[model samples]
Target: MVRYIETVLVPYTDKVKEELDLPIRQQSIAIFDVFRAHRCQEVLDALSKARIQHVFVPAGCTGELQPMDLSVNGELKAAMKNEFMNWYADMVAEDLKDSSTINKVDLRLSVLKPLHAKWLSKVFHDFEVKERHYLARDTGSSAIHQDRGINIEPHVFELYIDLMCQFKPNEVLNYIKMNEGYRLEQTLQICRKYKLSEATAFLLEKAGDIQGAFGIILQKLQAKLKLFVDVMQGGNTDKDLNVLFLEIDTLAIVIIQLCQRNSGKMDEASREALWFPLLETVMTPQRKLKDIDNKDVLDDFNKLTHHILNSMMGYIALPAILQKIMQDPAYNTGKFGEVRELILGMLETYNYEQTLMKTCKNLLNHDIHVHLKSLTSAAVRGYIPRGDNCNLCNKLFINQNETDSVVVFRCGHSYHLPCLRSVGSVHVMDGEEMWACYLCSHSKRGRIQSTRFHRSLSNPNQAALQQTKEKSKEMTLDSQHIQAIDAVRKAMKTPSRMAILTELSRSDTRSVRGSSGIFHQENFQLRLAPPIAPTNS
Candidate 1:
């Protein structure tokens, strides 16, 4: 401990002072937890000698007051334990492989080696740096000062309500009660806004706000009814219309029960205002013909009358037919003919409006196209090509005297008609009849083909084959180099060759001395050649 103070703490303090140009008396003091080692007389004397003022935290308050204890120390310990476990696992595997026995000395060495490598310190320092920011944000004096009023925003209460509904529905009231930041009215409003009926009831009943709860239920019912009415009035598709009817039916039952519970409390005017719109909306038939119009006023009136007569006839005839079926002797026998007739009638009635609408739309589209052509001819003069160059062939468009036709696409790129036809033909081979911009199409095709090729290469057998081929090529080159090296080493290791080399080295040195009067080591070339055997002759 004394050595750590002298070597690490003293040097750190001196470096800080030098870097910041701080005077000895102005340097910051160090605060420590109330551990026995930190408070000992020896450590205190060492800190005093180094001019490092230190203070200890009060007993049993480290968890709350000490930042390291609050954040950094736990993470540090966990990281060290993880590192130690990994090291121990590796050592265990090594021991099993070598068939060696383990002992306390091996375990100690395993732990100490990583410590000496400074692995734990690196992990602890990282954790300390990360925790420092959070400590400042959460435990700073400014953050510690709590607002002692119920001044939370409406959106915050909404978020709290949604969280409570998703995770803790039963504990919602308890959460609101515990958090003074939330008010009873805010909680009620959120519960109503999010359609949390049970939570609203709970909060209202807890606060003895029964009338408020009834009002919330009514408001939710009214909103649903309004949505249902809107969908019914504006909904075009049969599927959506049917779904809206089903939702309205379900809401109708709930609304009835709510009205029954508050029958006396809800006045006639409020009841009429709520129920009349829903009743009128439900009773009124969908105005499909109102959406269509004929150019002639008399023709439109005639068509409307014709539709009204057909509807009246169907309504009158269907009920009579239903009555006849009920009266039939075979009605109780479950015969297929009657049921099939009923289903066919229902389908025909359902498809009549849809088929008429489609026919009218087709006629309108034809008329619109005719009008557009006339308008275009009156307002526009001639076809002007957007660009001069063909995007595909990279050639300029020829004049009308030279070329038969030119094509201009909606994307503003121009091409000769023949060039566009050729591009289309090429794309047709890939199951595309139309052509996009050449660069975009090429890049898209390349990406698709590359993805398919990559998927094929991802197969394990193909990967293994590729890896084996690479390794074999590498081994072939390695073997050739190894053989060459071995041959050289073998030639140099021979006793006869070694003696020749020694003699050559001495002669080269003597030659150098004779030439310059200063002996220098000469570079000698050593070549290995294969021995040739003598012929049988």
Candidate 2:
């Protein structure tokens, strides 16, 4: 299981200890789980003697390195199993025909081949099973759980991509378990949002078994869009996704070949045949954001070209364009502009800013920043986060920011209060209807009656309903108070339970001033009955 690179072993074999200088005292190293079982006691002793740090992992889980282990691995395993069965049947037939002439080599071949085949199958099976389970676990663990409502963080895009890219598919798959069955949709959403039809087609190709899988699904979409777009365009230029399917297939083949070369399976000449041309064709300086002209196919490639190169290399592989946007400032700055314009456009078109601004003054004034343009595009198109700019704006704010008159929502939208009030009146003639946020239009407000009833609730600094000793004894049980406590107990049932309970509690206590009288959480304000005259009494 110890998967040392061929080059690493070569140094030891050639006795070039000096040339192969490995760090004697490294702080950290990340090894795939494939090699964990090979960690011998001697290595452990060496670690102890040198005071070096190391970690161990289980086997049969190196999905990133093994392409067969990605979506295609399952089918490959079944194919291997089928091959084994057929081979076994042939061996049985041969042995039955000539039992007396059966040799030890024949027996060994019969036994060993199936065992090896089974071994390979099991490796992939373990990966598939664990991956499926991990997704389930992650879905349940996410902040978007029922009790917590929704947590719309802009940083999630970055976090998800970081985790997914650094780890193998199985390693990162757990992070998006709830989104497992919806991968194709999510992938398409990202591409469509970013206008990355090329990337979308590439991803769909890798999710194999076209007859039942993405190929057919996307074809159906292509057909549907053809009808929709052709009618609108009057048949001028309505290209369907199927037109690009062949190109996508060709790209995937090139990628697999590139991976084979990288893995050292290809001869040097063959490697040169593929690598030299590709590198020469696509490589470009960080400054030039786009390709200017067309030359030989092997001419210098730019960001978009490199992105295609990576996709042609592997579905899960991170394109240089994406990586640059994530890390390199030269590229990230450019990418940020694209993201900013996209956000502004989405907000303007959907009137998101107006809706979110109704909630608080803070949201109205805050600036927003977005990253991972590819992923964000998907989120916007699919409404995955159901709203945009939530996480981006939060990260944009810091202690130095002076926007005290603001509030943010779960979907990462923000708004200002004073600007919101001038736009519309907060009115509720009766108690049944939920109040509306004419500003953000996110959700109808819960019944908040008698707005002026609880002054303490408006300001977090104030204490509402002080528990004096005299009143504490008489107020043994307020039904509403008891209900509030009971709800909290229910919320504590899970880790996310407290968030729901806290919101409910806030709703119960909150009140606002209205045109008629004091308001309470139930959406009604009370005008105290006029006091009777002392003489009359």
Candidate 3:
């Protein structure tokens, strides 16, 4: 049946279509709790095709899919309550019609269908909201304002400001508003005339608004492009180039957007300072720079590194070298206020602090212990693949006599069963007649296949079978002798046990020296008395 959803959602909906929300607007989102659970490959493939970027919610948070879990669970209970009442009413009506009949079937149908529909609707809506809340912003640009006189009209300025404002509220409200006497129009003019480099510096030092700094950079890039165009057309401007402005602007924009997307992560500010110099080196004319000795820059570099460590917490183990550097009290505590401030600024740009906080709590509450148990369970299922080929040897034995028989190993690698069985008797560990892997020494551990050389060994004719059984018995006897030898070698380590065993071996009665009727001293004396003469008489 075609179900009409009032909004765009269904159970196991497409991810790209679902999570259109951005800046993590919802307190919770309903994604599959485990990425590997429930048609995840199909969903993930769809997301990849749709170019949807995502941060996986930490495990155990599906119960917290924002408002859905909170509100929908209660709604389900209420629906159940209503269903019960309705069912009761239906039963009463049926009883009135016929006092003897329970009318069980109709009563059940009345209560169940509506309640199920209601609960399903709640779940669908909850997921739909989560999807819609995460869609990326519209990225197409509509116009370019490239005038260079610094006195463009106010209305145009407001329109551009409004448009930019929609994308970056925190940036504008928290930083841009602080710059007085410099309207957006003037910033644009400065960008057109001085190149984005000079203008970005002017804005950063003068206006302190990062957005304004970007505005200047954007104009300078446009001017540089125009300059390039003019030169290609056989004309060159005498104006000196200010290339660093464009470079700084590009890097700054990327960093700022990262900050915006991550909800003012705590480490972003510091990282940005570090990121600028590295990015500048890429664009600078010299192509290399002297070692960065700026204390503020160094601190920011460390902060950026730490932030990356937090962001990729699920994957790489942070390098010990970096961790060691970061943990030093002198490095952390001796910094200037601006250096410290830069480091702290990064925290404002992303939620790394929150993630760390959550992790710390899990550690404290023995969540790690539970996690370790789960890991051990998963480990038992299989080894984590190192992206290498199967390491076990593939060779299998084929008994010359048996064509049909094959032996299997416990590890699932297969060999000719008949050949393997001929080599080793049935292992008592598992009922299967199997052979040990020569490499791993695990008998009955892998799958065994029949080989060409061993057709007769597998034959079940009485003569062949009897012969095979006799051979097996002989092998068992030999194996027992080997085991006995091994046991003797083990026992020989103790001098007293070895002495008792040696004396026992010397006599026909097969009794130890102390336990037999003849005492050791008496037997020796009788041997010396020449008892053979009395026997002849």
What order do you get sorting by lDDT, best first? 1, 3, 2
Per-residue lDDT for 93-183 in model 1, tens only? 8877787785432656775886646876678557744653453344333444555323446567557567766655665655554444456
lDDT of 3 at 473: 44
Which portions of model 3 show Cα errors greater than 4 Å?
Answer: 1-345, 349-368, 371-463, 466-537
Clashes of 1: 0
Please give the range of 10 consecutive residues that has the lowest summed lDDT in model 1.
449-458
Q: How do the predictions measure up, each by TM-score?
A: 0.19, 0.19, 0.17
Name the better of 1 and 2 by lDDT.
Answer: 1
Best candidate, lDDT:
1
lDDT of 3 by residue, 1-537 (tens): 112111333332444435664332222233444555433566554444434433455567755663554576655556566656775787678887887665555546686778678756765655544533331111212256433224435555444444434543323332333323337556555443433344344445344455444444444544544453344333344633234334434544554443334334336444343333332322231111114333443343344434443443322223432343267563345322323443355445335667888889978779778888988986677433222212221222333543443333445544444334544534666665334653355334564332111212222354356556555344333443345434444433232444445665685544554465334543233224545654554
Give per-residue CA lDDT, model 2, range 1-537, as digits (tens).
123423353334334434466454433333334454447766555444443355544555555444446667656766677766776687777877887665443546677877786767666666656765664555444455666433334345434534444433334323332343334555445444544433444444445322222233334434443443343335434554344334433443444443443435445444334433333222222123223232321132233344444433332222332443468664445534423333344336445545565655554334322345655785566313334222212222233633435444344455333222322324446764223343245234544322112222232223234223224333244354345434443433332344335544654343322332123224333346988868964
Q: How close is candidate 1 to the true structure, as a TM-score?
A: 0.19
Give the Cα error of residue 309 in candidate 3, in Å.
Answer: 15
lDDT (Cα atoms) of all candidates against the true structure: 0.55, 0.42, 0.43
Q: Which run of 10 residues does model 3 get worst, by summed lDDT?
A: 281-290
C-alpha lDDT (0 to 100) for residue 88 of candidate 2: 69
